[model samples]
Target: MSTKRKHEVPDQQEPKRKHVEEPDQQGFTRKNAEVPDLQELKKKQTEVPGQQEPVREKVLDHIYGNKFWGPYLSERQWCTVREETLGNCWDSTSYEKITHDSYRWGEDGIFGLSDEQQKLCMGLTLWNGKDSVVKERFFGLTGPQGNLGEDVKELYFYLDNDPDHRYMKALYLYPQTEFPYTDLIEQNKEGFCHSAGKGVFDDGHWQIIVEYTKPESDTILCRYTVTNISTGVQTLNLSPKFWFRHDHDAKHMTDVSCFQVKGDESVVSVSYQLEPDCCYATYKLEVKPGGEDIIEWELLPVGKPSYIDNSSDVIQEWKIKAETFYNSLYDCQWSDQEKAVAKGAWAGLLWNKQFYYYDVDELYHRGQAVENKVKTVKPGNWDVMERNIKWRKHFKAKDILSVPDKWEFPWFAAWDTCFQMIPFCRLDPDFAKHQLLLLLSERYMSPEGQLPGCEFNFDDNNPPIHAWTSLKVFQMTGETDLNFLFNSYCKLQKNYNWWMTNLQCSDKYIFYGGFLGLDNISVVDRGCPPEGYSIKQADATAWMALFALSMVQIGIELTRHNFPSPGDIQKDLIKYLKDFLCISHQLNKDIDNGGMWNLEMTFYNDVLVDQLTEQYIPIQVRSLVGLLPLVACGIVNFSGIRCTEELKQALQTDSIHVCDITCGTVNFSGIGCTEELKQAFQTDSIHVCGVIKVRSLVGLLPLVACGTVNFSGIGCTEELKQAFQTDSIHVCGVIKVRLLVALLPLVACSTVNFSGIGGTE
Candidate 1:
């Protein structure tokens, strides 16, 4: 017998073993046979023909090999905050300036593709043979140039993409005639006059399709199919461009991005030599057009490729895999058309991912040799710029972040990223988890626990959705990764504390400031109300309520799982529940007594309180701000929660009590459609004055909040009876006396026009 364990031997044959359930790298349950003998494991690891590891395994391993190449290239890198060298971002960099200038942060181009870290990038370029310059990057108006803020004028679509970027595709229509670059700039600068540019149907254009497929983890294959949609034959110049992201200092730089070209003109090959002592990628491109008039390329690492399959065959095989992967994601039955829509939506989400790199420390200290050139382009704004960025010296971000709009935003907005992760959680939960954690991590989250809102201004207030989304993602992923739950909960506590300390109004449950991510919808800019007044926003208070509810749920989950300290969780849970009740009490209080709910109109509105006079002036604007409170509802199952004596006592506190379900005839006395509503709608004339008594969606929110519609408590038959017969229904100690007569029918018929409520010139 060997002295060492038989299973540990590198090359020892063993008999068949029984299968058992075990947790994998990502905590996903899988059924696999007992750990194979050392020899069998070694044999499986070796590359054998016609065998490849599953993509799910690759994702679970959390290795950088398969994810090295992706659609991480940004669609727009110009005019980004990182490149705002001048005091003004919009005026400092233009499309023409960016073409010739070097970007210090990242790179962008048409049909762009880059590695995970974006050291070197590869993208497509085109020329119609009549334009002044080749069309490389996308053309979009700067913030001030366009009538609307910033916009991408060209039409394009992200056709397809997998979670792992194993297979991806996109389409762009390029006109044969010169682009309308100068026309757009000149027209928008003068006035709102604009053109749609050259039409693809009338003007001779090329429908270009770009596709990428990975044959192996370390190998990538790209294909471009350009078809002339014109009646006559047309000539178009196409080139695949590759280059390293421009850097200034070479003396201290250890790893350099290098590119080498080889092979003949007919079949050209290029190699990207990455960091020293690491893998290098070699790609073969057919310079000559194939019989189908398409260009094809293959990228391979240093090792020999296992198969010599044709590009078409390889692409078709991966396309099938992509289809299978997407199919597995659907949990319920969906029509083919519905499935197609979902695929397009998910593709856009995955394709918009960009490699975001911003270092505030570098921007603040200006210590790095390459950072010396960072200065205000305007003559006298260096001091102003320094004053603005001085407080954010600890902020540093260098990660693959999901941007809201790569062309327009091209950076993270705190609230938008939280919403994006909801869909992203379905594709790659681990990556989604990483994204949420990245913001909460010490590198991004402030020392005071305020998450950086966006790249432009770190202190700008965004909606508090971080804690809510963190719990959402965790639940979506089968509630695995408790470490994520524990860590996020700890940080979320600090964030919640920060909100209470900073945004809350004088120890009241109401919160102030913030556009609440709803810009231009308010009467005045709610972020900056009239000088002597402070606007208590309905949406802001509702957001805090939701945040508090989410924290309580997270604390309960942690306690149930016996994570670390149950005693601590109980204390935190009491605090969270009490905070939620306080917020709910303020929201539910009568309008005459400083609450958001207006008893006469039965709708929530922002109240402008004069700081000195103490007058509560309600800004009665009908919008989503009033209805946001509906999202703050959550069911508390005391049966599952470890309800201690303290928990029971907390529930019995002021404004917090359990109530039985009650239903009665519909109440139409005080809540019917009023004369002022008819005037605002029938005449199409709007006035901010008068007691506006319109039955908007806000009136029906409380009725829907207590498990009546789209909730669990009400049975189908009983719900219909209550909704039809009952004048009022009360559940869980919330009021629902307002009638939904005019609003519900109007909304159902799609005849409820919001513009009628508030006139637009």
Candidate 2:
């Protein structure tokens, strides 16, 4: 539940429940006419002559209200909190105590790491009585159901035998800021426990005292004064649901409707899903004609209900339904909930309507009111949605300091996240632009345009697909920030140069250096010698080819931002592509070229010479690295989607057949998922989707993005639903982009831009 805005405005008659009215195309009701159906209200409207009325379902039609920050009225609060436990919970002693839901009391357990306590995993937020002030939002998800918290606690950190999963936590406690807490306390501090004390303790409510500012950064700052009684000391952990809704009643929750209307006599209706422990009733929110709680009023729930349940079965169940228990919630002899529904009338403001969610934690002593309110705000909702439209005003996390819940590092995918935000581009173009900026921005991006593989551990490696994302953001948004992209171009050149310099054994850098290999997306994670020696591979060469393609597109966008000609950058991309492929073609020759096929199987030809073959690359799922070059199609918009000619030249691929030779044919599978056959063994009928065992998902992510979907991946099914629903504000906004790219590119591009940021705000 949630709370309402502090100010009470002018009031009007609450529409009788007996007859609900339909709202107009603008989500408002006509002057006292029968209300329209829900489907009709959501229909697209045809703009009239010279009218600026917004159409239904457009981005403007939505007003984002953050579920977490909406709880504030005058102060800022932290969204996440930590500094509670160590990072090593798998120790025999600690493992025995933790459970799946250990988050209920463990320290910094949001992502489920039981050890390594230093920084609080919490950050703050402020709505300013206006709308929003969201810089970024990070989701610390891990394990099944996307919850690392449950896994660490219940699964005992899974570190007993597996050290690899040990890495991952909300806080590392950098020395820049240091705060302390009681060490394994055996005694309770008196003031810590809430009681009707002389000074600190109070009978109103239990409090969770916290501080986010470290004196060096703009972190969360807050104070507490709950309106409850019978205080509480700090409990182990608290988890509660907090989203903004209209709940006028302090005990339970209520919903209301309001919109901006000048002067009118109309009706409004509301439909809600009443649940257990949910109670409802109707009341008029009247502004005093002078200064009273009653200025105007109306009613419908005629009389007391059959009982208390929102579903109105007070005797059996304990909930209410909008139509079922309408009478019990309100005691009126005149109108009823059913009657209101029959005519389509509702109990809310006539024209303008907004919903209020009541806070029970504030009412009853309960869970994480402070941290939850500040930390976990869902983006693209009513609170921050409007603010996302203002780019310059939005916060940019260029520095290293941060509060938990605030996005410190933007963890983005190599290619999937970039193309996924197309629809979101329609909502906030600046956000879309920032999304690109956040990725290649001066922050996490290495000196080379290569964005870190992930945020926390930026040692060096993920897939090479940044150039594509940047070019996409530029084209999709149509905004040009030269300094932002050109500098990125410069870094990109450096990154490409590094590959050419370090990985090149003879000519271009091909299968020379070992790839970081995300989830093993390479043949053996490295190249092998013909005489047979496992060599670090430079899979980045193929990626360079695609990057060159996008580099050209980004250059043209560079010109729009008022930069000098993109000649230099374009030349570099082309030169790099040529250097890369010319060398790669020679080095990545078929088994005849004397290259080793597997990384871990044999050391060198001298060690294991019998297995070498013309086609046997010891194909592992990691072998998918070869597909990166294909992404060039989307970045340059080869079908005439790019911005300039100079840029286009940089991405010229005629000099090398990197894409052609690498992708001719290969059966890749996750480690051990497929049997690696000898080179002489050949087959045109290997099942790609089956071999990968992921239904073409992990295997074809790049293929689908580059518009090169395999037969299996191209076949559409309900799977699109899952791919489409990822949270636009927190994730890649894949679904949002898919929906809006065709309608208005500007508005939805922000979804893309923001997605690029990976909810790092």
Candidate 3:
């Protein structure tokens, strides 16, 4: 008798010579059967794909990978179409059209967008797996929207053959997981997000580790590690899927083709060409358990590639690159968490910056519209339109360094770039130096020697701080490379001439609008001039004086190098130093003359005038405006050269001339003059007045200027020494807070001894 029942899987062939009697469902019968040993079954399991072998202890010297906090999605959602696409709907009264039209776009909207939206809006370039030709294409998730989508789906891993067919989904691992929790998302110094995830298989309780790495090549490597945790023998045929949407219209589809290429039994390669952009995706499978697999994707232009033979080697190279970066930071004294944060921040900055040519058409149209508006307002200035057209024509965009914070302010501000160089120099000196030169490059700087204030309004002016920053870089690196210095000196000289010729409000004073990078701080609006009055700003005068002093120092450094002929450099240095002294003296005389200073109040203020009356009054505000003059105080070591009576008088008198300034309304009472300062003021010698207030870069400017103080002849006072100590501590405390402030002490103080510090040489 025999009984039949549904088996899990149909047996293909029965074993030979195996005969037995079988009973109905209620009865049992004996039969010859073969049962494998438990140890043998385990051994067989080790041979299966996507399994981990038992671990053997070894010394761990280098750590190449890091984990990060994973993102969590409360519920699966779809991305909405952009607003410009609303006209594409065929039926106006249809439900989909109504929903699309009513949907608000932004963070607070019903369908909130992620940072990915901003990042992916720009198209990406891919290299063709077949050849060297690279192509540019926009990619997104499939959605109802015409071309782009709002959300992307999370990738999944599953077994190829399973009865229930369970799939393991990616998620953010928490403290409850057995694996160590680390918030390290592998990225280059510039914050680009690679792939990072940790999860487990539902059936076998196997752990899955996934990471994405991009090496020097055009390929992106998606690596996976699957390890079995359950004691029972487990088997899995793993399949990983990558689903993405590309901008392929009917024309594009006709022009391009995609196909799969067979490699060894364990490898699968897919290649596609979309005109200018070609992409290849290669999937590698590991045959033995406890091994890892990789999916490599490359995008390039469709052409003969320069090099593309060693795909596997490229993947390994990426791993080594990551390990090298990790090791570089590992030697630092910073904690692991701090290093991770620093790496993330640096990578973010690098990734966020965009390198591209400027949009000529958009700028041309905008300039014309502005010219028309200006002509209507000032009919007498008929040539405004011509000038506007000329400027528009001159505006050519090239590859340039972008500001790190692109989301809020996309344009590069000259002064901001100067400060950004400080940290960038630490991370990559070459890049930082390149950025400094970029501002003065012909494509950006106007032929008239005007450094652009920001990207949008090229004609606007920013503070002339480029020379100051350049000097700083030279000093920080202790680099004697006069090439950068010589080039920068030439550009800075032109800029100085421009400021003196065009921006001068009077013979001594420089006039500037609010575009001086200090918005809302000025009494009069910086962008607009007061009716009928030409205003002279104290900060502008101070900045020019500082600029002149910077030039003098650069010339001095050049003289030391003996490249530009010591005679010529010295002559230029003396001229600039005199100009700086003259400016300083004139400012002091103005304060004494009660032009912008309140004698009774003892504070400096901005002056507004009635243009017709030729009379000016002070816009009384004690802010950075009053404190700026201290920035102009560059100490001179007048050991060899003869000092003119006028120069000596200017230096001595200017030192005591105080623009009664307070941090704000809270007065530090009288100027905190050390006995030395008081004596110098009484005797008319160079010295600094001090005050107690909230510490700031501006407040500390005087100390920087005091670097050149001739303390040997004019004895240093206890009060002066105390003030220096207090200010030094305060400046040190805030060094990490602002990049500009941090670099100020190092660059301004000539006495700093960097003998033992590495890299000084």
Candidate 4:
């Protein structure tokens, strides 16, 4: 036998495999025997053509490839994905359509749906039968054409009758080609279904999940088996009665989310809340008892995807022909591997957020999870929990599966997917790779080369870190497909260009700043900039530098293939960087080239709007901005005498540089063991006010001092790293300071000179 395992795929065949957690990767069950004559007892292997050797998905496990608590919905876990809501709150006239562009929560209230679009926004009603079984139904697609490429696995069951029973329904509908759990479902109804006239939780009776994909399919496809507790055997005797598709069509508004039951026992009667938008749905299930020859059918939702805009025949016109089906999703099939790859063509959506949310706030302020599973119902019901009540969403065990797919459900972002990719890799590398491919697809990447931001809009520029993340992924697994990744690198450059040109405000560099990306929004506007900061913002400036660095690094990788130059696209990057450092004196250095360096402050306090409005603003030199010079790594092209020896000297221990801004006092960042920048950070006399006294500014000094733009080098000093890694840093300035801190080491500790940090030759 060859030294390599006989089963081990050849090098020309595949890359080194890392066993991930996707059951589908290694799980060729007995169902396979039923589907085909193939059988293997002593470890037989069947190969799916395009499927990569069964490497366990490492990164996907955390986000998209999530492991549910109980009986997980399916083998294909909920990996972190990106999407946007199809439309504004469905109550609006255009409920069927998705929001044409992307969006962010709270940025613009999703209150577009008015009282008019009643059909799209009608309240849900649980029509309780004489058996006390309340039922509602939703048909995802009308037929094979209607399936919408859904690789169904688990159910997201939630209770919508009360505030506690939340609504959080969104689906990514992954492709079966990459990773599929088709065998996850029970073949037959098995034993018995729950009896009617019963209720669950607080005196309710209902259940869902029907054993059917289509009606005419030879697979005995749609079987609904239910057995009433009181009439167990008798109920099992009943045949399934699923209504025909041509009969009545309906699409259920998302209502509830359920993973699995403790024992699949019958103590729970499903109920419904009558609120205008209370989520509501009906389903079927399987239960095998002591003596049942074959599986049977039970009760299901009243309707399937039965309703369409009879008012307009637009949807009817949408047809599926092999020749005609390219862009639209109407004809896509889950099983067709080729179509799966193509239809998943999203533009690079959630790139900037890949590394984020590793430890962001997954918990709500109310000591509950910030996430909540949703079931769709009427429109008004959603506003119910829109209050300050934060809930832990069901992204698998409330343990955050990857990063969220922000901007509703239709369009998710790029970077967020990367963060998601980390954990998802553990469950199914195939799925994890697909998620990456999904982001790289044409839809998610914009015409301008920008990938989708964290929000729904593909146009908006969020953070610029896609290419770097792609490399990180490549490093973890040498599955380098330069062709595809280079395209992502190109798109990332566009985003970088947009970040610099569009968001930049000052003649000097600083990105957008505000609560929701609005300019002038102070850092203290929400403790962290909330949306993001102004380009001219001190922190924003540093971020711009860091983003530019990522672009250069990734751009170099793509450059090898002679990828087209992004033009003078990012040519002006260094101009403002050098200008800002010299004029702003972020490090408090003065002299030469008409520089205007500002001093550091001693504390952390909001720059009162009234002070600026009244022309009485305190122009204190602070460490926050002083350390900004540390942000100019690999972006700014230095020219002339802009960078004086005086400026360079200030970075050392010989002189004391100031950089604070609390109570009108200046403070500093980027302190070395004995560097001049160290004095201001260590000085204890710096009076700081606030309920939490350990001034965050003092702790974040290392970030600026050890200036290196690499994500690993962020907060290079032990103390700064401790604060970021140790968590629980609840200071208002912490996020911004951390962001700046994260950027500085890239510049401060960089091999390049400060003036040329942003690529100034």
Q: Estimate each model's TM-score.
A: 0.73, 0.35, 0.49, 0.35
lDDT score, candidate 3: 0.41
* Per-residue alpha-carbon lDDT of candidate 1 for residues 1-761, written as tens digits (9 for 90 to 100): 00011112123232222121112221112122121112343355465544444533443244446677788889888887776655677765888877545566778988787777775577888877777887888887888878777878777888889988999999987776778887877778777644345353376667788888878765667777776766665666666565556542222433333322322445423322222111112212112222113655554432235333477788888889988988987757888888889999999999999998888755543323332322212121333454237446677787899999889889998889999999999999988989998988888888888888777777777889998899899999999789998998998888999999989875299897566666446688887889998888888888898898888878877877788777778888888877876777776665568788776666778888889988888888777887776667553433344445665445333323211110111111222334543343332222223222333445457755343233345544656556545445534323344454212112110011122112212
Better of 3 and 4 by TM-score: 3
Write down the RMSD of candidate 4 (Cα, Å).
Answer: 22.4
User: How do the candidates rank by TM-score, highest first?
Assistant: 1, 3, 4, 2
For residue 622, give model 2's deviation from the true position in Å. 9.1
Error (Å) of candidate 1 at residue 52 is 23
Worst 10 residues of 4 by lDDT: 110-119
- lDDT, residue 47, model 1: 56
Candidate 1 vs candidate 4: the lDDT winner is 1
**Candidate 2 residue lDDT tens string, 1-761:** 11112233344444332222223321222232222223343343433443333443232223211111111111111111110112211221121122111221112222211001111122221111111221111122222212222111111111010011111111111111111112111112222311111232222222222111111011111211111123222111112111121212222223223322222346323333222111112223322222222111111111212111111122112112222433433345556555454222212110001111112122122222222221211111122212112222222332211111112211234343454334334433444444555555554454543344432223335555566666555556555455556765666665555555555443223434343543343323243344543343324444554554456456545543436664454455456445434543443343335432233421111111233432334343333343332333331212222224543333322332233222222222221221222211223422344221112223334433432223243554566545544554212322222221111101100000101111110
Highest-TM-score candidate: 1
- Model with the higher lDDT, candidate 2 or 3: 3
- Displacement of residue 633 (Cα, Å) in model 2 is 3.6
Count of residue pairs whose backbone atoms collide, per candidate: 6, 125, 34, 200
**In model 2, which range of ten residues has the least summed lDDT?**
745-754
Q: Give candidate 3 misplaced runs (Cα > 4 Å).
A: 1-296, 299-341, 359-390, 521-523, 589-596, 633-761
